[model samples]
Target: MLDIAKLARQMPEIGQQMQKDAQASVKRLEMAQQLFFQANEHQDNLIKAQELWCDRLIFSPGTPVESLDTAIDIPEAPPSHSVFSSDGSQIAPSHHEIIYCYLINIGRIMLHYGQNLHPLLDSIPEIYYKTEDLYGSRKWGIRTEEWMGYQRTLKEIQILTEMACTWVNPPGAHFNVPNLAMTDGSLAFWFLDTLPTEAREEILNPVIESWEQLRESKIPIVGYISASRSTEAISFLRLMACPYDVPNCNNYCSLDNEKNPCQKVEPLRDSSLWQKILQPRQRSAIFRSNSRILDFYPESQKTHFCYLHGGAEVARIEFPQWIAEDSELLNQALSITLTQIDKGFGYPVALAEAHNLAVVKGGDRTQFFSLIEDQMLRYGVRNVGVSYKEARKRGSIA
Candidate 1:
């Protein structure tokens, strides 16, 4: 059990430390804001810095697609449009359970605006119990949880693509409405970096295929991240602050750490910088991600992102290069996103609804295990049991 009394005794000291940290953070934010405006004024110089040192920079910084200071107000959405979103939930395989198995549940939603059509909401659940499914090849060295997560992400996009394709070619009616497809988080498979080359190819190939299908169907898809802590834009500012002719962190900073000039704008996120620059419903300039994983991705499917002030907070929206290059599609995507945020009162309604449908509560997990045990007993399986630790966690003797 937690020692509440001891924790209470330390609250005063914790509060004081937090207060001091907050003050320091405020000072850093002020310095960052000043540097941000200065960088904006000299966008040309920053572009030159990127040209000279982009390949050698240690940190991944965003490459601007347009002027660095560009901020565009949210465009008006089409009169009639559709929005499709998908989210996934997973029950990881655990040893304490009645069975060594896992489940993936994908919740998909479709919403139509300015039309009298009913919205579609449903979840598809799949179970995997085979040894090959549970533990992949030993040579891959991928953890079960990471592998399951990658599978879930792949399932989410595939489902989104299937739903959008159906919308594009409905059975009875011709739905001529412009549409947007979205998922819950970053589209870039950054975690694949941990896997071997063959393992990365196994996971990435299908995802890229789905992206290609969406592109062929002219359906714009995005990944929305709320209160994002990404520092790509801040890293760009650091490039602007480099006083040396060639911006090399390792060559100079490793020898003399105290004199590093970029530390002036230390510890501020991209969202913090945009919060000061963007008004509500405005979006900052789109920037291409410099993730090394994109080297494996096709040029057209490379990840690009922008920050939008969605009334309540700054949100990072990521999409493929195709959407980033098309003005009409980009505007349509941003407008629909802002509209969804308005309807959901800060977050996208489609995503929020999909999350509601995908989430597996504690009660549901308990019931799932109960169902498994009951089935095992019905089949006269004697191996069914729970770990002593699990049993102790379920009940206590006072």
Candidate 2:
């Protein structure tokens, strides 16, 4: 009567279907966004109030911005005054309107790492390296040629800085709100060995040299933000990149992007929240009357599990009993926490291995504790620990 094998055989297919469904959902959202914005011809204050940092150019596919000598698209735009069309329709440029380069499309977010000679130093350092075991997990290292990744990141920084230099900071620059270099990666440091020595000096010399001047003069600020997998990393880097040292403070856009796809973040504690508050945006998708689409719970959401492995470079804290709790309030909290850990769940956060709270027993509590501890260490987690004795006293079983 046992059908274990039969059930096992169907899981892969089931997983594949779920993946397709998730992807489909993403596509649908993208489409809806386009339709909503375009329906009003970029008006209506729904989507195009302000240019999105990386929303798929909802208005038009990017075209080569013609010559910089003639690059100021809105010459009519006053330096600080809001320029209006002859028809009086508002046509505000993106806040990031660097005169020389416009962000054509936002590429995927990438993590940057660094080394204090520790892969997952139990204690976080003040800086990260692009190759220093991203997120303190071996699995997270870029698979491409280390040199190539180095070159690519370097190039990205250079291009961005150049954009700032010519377009954002150029003489007669339009609006000035401090030049913020929002990157998920490390801002100041890079892996030199991965790059040819000549390329290293050539590419980084400008950034280093120019940044030093900015650091000294205190007129324009360059900030480094590292909100990668580690909150400690963020704190640590923020300290290292002191406002004077690197004043900009990795303040990326706050108005709810995919990293924080949910707009109505309860408690709204993430660093990004402060960013949204500080740099308020209206007539843009980042802020609106209805709030971000993230607040509305959608049906057909998929749940994923991360098999908790102990002592891993990145470890998550979860219990084998949350799902089993009988308390109404406790159960709700448990479900929310567990769903947050789902690899497929919205937003990125620390993760742990999956434990079927439904099936685990009080007897297996010791093993569970051991598992959690080991997984945590392996993943560079030093925050929480599993207490088998506590579990046992509470009659916890495997």
Candidate 3:
């Protein structure tokens, strides 16, 4: 376990001890690093590393895909007849089918899945697909309903938790049947494509196996990640470690991504790990900073960069690389939601977002700051203070 106390104390002295090295590590926080791919032999072996943990290795059929054959017989029927939308427009937003319950805290967050007429300040509505009469009365023990006006969307709530548990929990992280991997989207595929064969075998294969099994069985995956930011890492660990809080200790986003824009890929730069991978110019183009790389290339977007074996091939011939524009899509949101308060030196800013998962993609990690500012402006409420427990005690069913 990472000792937050030690990290906090040691952080101040790092620059003095190791100036250049510390600066380089800090520079990595910028999202413009290149993805490292292993040699052919290493690549082949990485695919084989899952002999122990998992039964077999495979990619999940996320979006429907029909692959081309060697013989190239009359091409199979396409997954979608046309890439355009109903209105015949080319651009179609890939609806976020999965929900990752990233920052759920029993103390900070109040989750109400089943019907219980209570609307705490932090209350979330879980919409149920079925009606109350069918099971609310007959199967009261399992499916009791209490007109949860605040939590009218049970299915949505359940799925969000499932997605959260899937990404954070590692394979075999919990004895209970686990949510192994995330929805293997284009970003993941692109990340996989850039991995070195050695790293792929050692670190990624087990993860890939976890994804494949979940896909085959329709089981949700626990997408595990560790925090890139120190503050976030501590907060996440604290919430998850508490027995009464976010169950399933899913450590998300601490792994080394060759193409991670946030981290400067210096150690492996020009190393054998990046042999025939993306070109240097293309590397700069794709490994951009402060852009939502996932949105840039989405499975729901186009056949942009989602090509793999037995899938729609997006090889180097068609689309050379994945590039992120200098677009701060959330800038407007952040400007409206964040607030400044008195603190030492300058001031501290508090950011928060209401419980929402449907349209809010990529967890509420970045949105909270944007949201807090917006809520304060509305209703002339600078800040309506409410604790987690206080919200649950509210009498309103909302």
Best by TM-score: 1
TM-score of candidate 1 versus the correct structure, residues matched by position: 0.94
RMSD, candidate 2, Å? 26.2
lDDT of each: 0.86, 0.28, 0.25
What lDDT does model 1 reach?
0.86
lDDT of predicted model 2: 0.28
Instruction: Please give the lDDT score for candidate 3.
Output: 0.25
In lDDT terms, which candidate is top? 1
- Residue-level lDDT of model 3, residues 177-247, one tens digit each, is 21111111122333323334453343334433433433343332211111111121112112212232212
- Judging by lDDT, tell me the better candidate of 1 and 2: 1
True-structure RMSD for candidate 3: 21.6
* Ranking 2 against 3 by lDDT, winner: 2
Deviation in Å, model 2, residue 259 alpha carbon: 31
Compare candidates 1 and 3 on lDDT and give the better one.
Answer: 1
Question: Sorted on TM-score, highest at the top, how do the candidates line up?
Answer: 1, 2, 3
- Backbone clash count, each prediction separately: 0, 40, 46
